[model samples]
Target: MFIISLTYKTSLENVERYIPGHNLFLQKYYDSGQFIASGRKEPRTGGIIIANAQSMNEAEQIISEDPFYIHQIAEYEITEFIPTKYNENFKIFIED
Candidate 1:
C-alpha cells in the first residue's frame, strides 16, 4: 500500500480550478481499483490517497496522472508501507 500526500504549491483559488478535473481522475483510478480511499486533509491544505499497487513505481505512475500533478498545483510525497496490523474490516486492504 502507498500513502500519497499532496501538499498544495499553489493558491486555494488555483487548486479549486482543477478540483473538478482532479475528481474525474480520481474516479478513474477508483473504478479500476487502484485507489482505496482519498480525501482532503484537515484545514484543507491538500489531500491524501491510499492506494494499492504492485510497486512504488506503479504508484508513482498512477499519481502522475492526477490533475493536481499534471498541472503542477500540488507536490506529492509517497510513502510505501507494509501493514502489520489493522481492524478486520481492513483485512481486504492488506490482502493480495
Candidate 2:
C-alpha cells in the first residue's frame, strides 16, 4: 500500500479551484479499485490518500493523474508500507 500525503503549495483559494476535478480523478481511481481511502487533513492544509498500487512507480503513475498534481497546487509525498496487522474488517484491502 502507499500513503500519499499532499501539502498545499499555493493558497487555499488555489486549492479550492481544483477540488472538483480532483474529486473526479479520485472517483476514477476508486472505481478502478486503486484507491482505498482518502480525505482532507485535520487542519485542512492538504489531504491524504491510501492506494493499493503494486509498486512505487505504479503509485506515482496513479498520482500523476490527480488534478492537484496537474495544476501543481500541492506537493505529494508517497510512503510505501506492508500491512503487518490490521482489523479483520480491513482484510479485504490486504494481499498476502
Q: Among these predicted structures, which one has the highest lDDT?
A: 2
Q: What is the TM-score of each predicted model, taking all chains together?
A: 0.95, 0.96
Tens digits of lDDT, candidate 2, 1-96: 999999999999989999999999999999998899999998999999999999999999988988899999999999999999999998988964
For candidate 2, give the lDDT.
0.94
For residue 65, model 1's alpha carbon misses the true position, in angstroms, by: 0.6
- List the candidate 1 regions with Cα displacement exceeding 4 Å: none
Residue-level lDDT tens digits of model 1 in 11-93:
99999999999999999999998888999999989999999888999998998888899999999999999889899998877
Find the 10 residues in a row with the least total lDDT in model 1.
87-96
Question: What lDDT would candidate 1 get against the real structure?
Answer: 0.93
Q: Assess candidate 2 and give its TM-score to the true structure.
A: 0.96
Candidate 2 regions with alpha-carbon error over 4 angstroms: none
In model 2, pairs of residues that clash are none
